[model samples]
Target: MPQPEDDPGSAPRAAGATNAGATPPDPATVEKLRSTIGSLSTATLKQLDADLPWYRGLRPDERSALGMVAQKGIASFVNWYQKPVSPEWVLSDVFGTAPTELTRSISLQKALQLIRVVVQVVEDHVPFLAPAADQAPLREAVLRYSREVAFAAADVYARAAETRGSWDTRLEALVVDAILRGESSDALRSRIAAVGWKSQARITVMVGSAPSEPNVGFLNELRRVTGRLAEDVLVGIQGERLILVLGGVRDPAKAYPRISELFGDGAVVFGPEAESLVAASSSAQAAFAGLTAARAWPGAPRPVSSEDLWPERVMSGDDTARRSLVRTIYRPLLAASNGLEQTLSAYLTLGHSLEATSRSLFVHANTVRYRLRRVCDVTGWDPLIPREAYVLQTALVVGRLSAPPAPPVAANGAPGTGNGRAARAGSIDKAPPVPLGRPSAL
Candidate 1:
């Protein structure tokens, strides 16, 4: 049994003494050794089948292919022993029998294990085949040849790994592009599946300025950090912008600060969360729009939500932004109660003054306060908070703009007719009239 140090196919070592400075074996002895190489290859394969779990698990065809490699390795060693001074040609002659695809099927470590088994089998047979005087030198040659083979195997696998990495990177970029383009084709899904994207849901897209120079190291570090956070990220760099589609984020706002520094110096905006990657284009569109509109808000947070720039986005003719404001803020408040919407409008119109809004609407101050609270409950925006008040006011304006054009009023207060019947219109008509200096249900 080989000890750990004598593990024949560990890393390659510097070439030592050629045949331990002994005389080369005679031609007769070399022929005898060559005749036994076939048996040696067969025995090595049998030993691998018995001792190596991975070898035993290979399909019959794969095993046959690997057996050919072992036979070629044995024959190559015998050829190397004949000319011990030149071992450079031995690697190609040994590995040339196996196709490039074999490297993909078997890992480098397993290939090294195969080399070790063959070397051990050849070493064990050296004494039986070589003349007594040449046995030690023959064993020494086997060890040296094994070392060279190990190095050759490492080179093959390294090249294979590099190629695979490059291919995967390109495929990942394609998947991100498909997501951004909102193309949910079967081919796109297959491409994403090929890249092994683990997170299917809770996806968010973030857009920002890319660094001035290529920074592979920074991108790698960002990947490492997101991986540690159990997030899946697909990144793309287009001109000066960087886009990242992140998945499995429970709270995008909380995740932003950690990744903000990884972005280039500029406004970084996170889009709304989507249920899954298939629907992430909606999020990506919003983020891309926000990136274009972020300049409008000079005081925008470093990692602002795409929805936070709704006013700017709406102004920029983003129908999604206008519809989002109407759906999330205006519709809900409008459906809850006319009084809630009217009081909210009055408060904002009165500069968020409860007393002033009450006086203007003919309601007591307490009714205005109650309506304001209801507005907060309905819209998740408080009239008391300056920032939220601004959002609410913007939503009101956007909602009115997005609403259908009102029917023309006639002299009689009827829409498109000139009758004298009163018509309910605007906020004041929605609120019940309050007696002078008396509170009313808002």
Candidate 2:
């Protein structure tokens, strides 16, 4: 018997070689076994349906493929009994008889179970196939062949798993790339399903530097670790960057602190939660932007939220940060009444000094403190802390930038706001008065 190696198709050949020494049954017995191949195959299929609920649940084509495997195994056994040739032929002749889809659909354990059923059926029929004198050697040959096919089945599954892992890695990369690029399509959705992402509850994107010399095992180890942290996670390592799409994390810090330790020494940033993978593109963009912008905050935490790095992200010219700041702080303050926007603006601009802001706004210091408290209440950002104040200041700038151009001065000296349809009833039809120095042509 040839020694089994780690390479594909080697172990199976060794198994075939092991079967080489099994004494072939008598001609009458071999002929009977070969002739009854059809009946034995039928019995195996019937036993499969009766004994294995999972087999009955299989798609019709998959069940049919497994039946073919049984038929081929029996046929190969009879042929090997007569010929007893080299190792190369057995894998192709026995296990290879089943299609790739069969292996993919059914696990190695189930395949072994199928082998057991086939061996059992043949054993039950041995009495009819051969007389008592011929039965022992025939049973021994069947046992040897079963051992060989079992090893072959294991080898095929190992190879299939290796191939699948490689394919899933590439597919994950494609899905992550599509997310970062903001490409959503039927194809991308299908690819996500193929990659087996299950974090349907909440999706988040994390970006950081990649560890050195990350290999297949390195990624596999990460998968093992993250399998517990988040419900579903897709990991992609690009050049020096590592990106992860985490699903089902209500609070990333609680669920993901362990993951941050695994990242390369640098800032790790998590984007806001997204509703779905397609929507996660927005989160991915934000996380990438924060990672690029994280360097500006030397004192930033090991793992910081993208929202927390808005100041640096704004400096990096990230539109997401700009919009986020304007929405979260600028718009909220504007919407809240009682001079919250004005007081907060004064508080930040005047260097977080309550008295100075009160003096500038001609309000009581107590009132300034009250308005700052209200600012926190309305915007969920405190203007009291220097860092929070700086964020508020940036939000003010972004909000101002995002504001519409000063409504063009109207002829009647009122701000010409809104389209004509919503303007003063006659504004659209009224012609402008000619300039004082110019000729007023009719």
Candidate 3:
């Protein structure tokens, strides 16, 4: 039932039918466009400067590169008008005229603005460049070419973003790994600069288990999220562990609760702040050490401070924790009022009995209570709390081991005989290691 006059055209005719009404510009007009490219470029640049507020703000060389782009686009349109083939060369013919670095200096939106300026300049000169009969096709050609340019600009920018994103991710990993290795090398410094790290002070480290289902997109989201909470951040996902180095967050009291839950099911640990990213190894080491020992304290708070795990870290052989125990507990108690240290020692060694401790020091029970409160204030650990007392006793042993006083001379001039070694606290008098157990009293 085919109608004899309803035959479709041949391949060439069908393909040519796509542009049936809008014709390619005549050779004379194409040659004219070629001749006027320079004028068109000048007009485009002037239009860009006048119409776009940000165009004048570009550096001289950057502006010159954009001029190259405008000139090349006009030339490309002239070439395109001859055959008016597919717009495949839009990327190379137009954007490729400028140096590769130009794309980085200019944004896609700004690129479109300049492309619009180029198209507008060509349209304004259409009457001068073409005869009365040729003006409509010339306008149509310019319109089609400008549409291709806009699409090409978007595609080029999208690729540039992906390339830059990948390079930044690798650079960030290298910097974080270098910090983990305690490297402050010149190359490391250069890498940090390349990563655009902003904070030069108060760097901190947080470590936890990586998610079971690892996702590059999740890491990206993490970087995006923390970038707001911190002045700078570095993220690394190595094997099963995820490490983060945050900069410029001097106090994370409010930020930690939200941040800690971002990690997987495990203890999250953050170390104290270091002065700079180069000095962040101290923080990283402490955080990693706490992550290793955090399992000891099953009920330890999520996202626990490395310093908060001093007792567990000490048990796990962290020398830094040992030194901290001596500094935080022993040294502070040594400089406190006379009775605080003795009261803590008596209270623990006397089975944590207030009455027994009052008698051991020959002080009233009310006096012992007062001293215990002072102990809590001095060391920030309460002797009345069972767990904190454990930490205090461990600190006592570490402190005693760190610096054991010399034996005293007796009245009869005998050395090492005045004070017996019987679990005394804060006395140059002899004392054994503080016991971890209590006498089953309050």
Model 2 weakest lDDT span, ten residues long: 1-10
Clash list (residue pairs), candidate 3:
none
lDDT of the candidates, in the order given: 0.81, 0.82, 0.83
What's each prediction's TM-score?
A: 0.86, 0.82, 0.84
Minimal lDDT window, size 10, model 3: 9-18
Better of 1 and 2 by TM-score: 1
Q: 283-382, model 2: which lDDT tens digit per residue?
A: 8988888889989999988788889899999998888788889988888888887889888888777777888989999999999888889988887778
lDDT of 3 by residue, 1-442 (tens): 1112233421111123135445556889878888888888888888999999888998998888888888888888887777666565667777774635667678888888888888989999999999999998888888887887777787788778889889998999999999899998899989988999879887899999988987878887887778777888898989999999999874588777677877888999999999989999989999999999999999998889998888899989999999989998999998996778778988999889999998888889999999999999999999999988999998888898899687886444567545434223235455567779867876
Q: Supply every candidate's count of residue pairs whose N, Cα or C atoms clash at under 3 angstroms.
A: 1, 0, 0
Candidate that scores best on TM-score: 1
Off by over 4 Å in 2: 1-12, 15-25, 198-201, 401-442
> Best to worst by TM-score, what's the order?
1, 3, 2
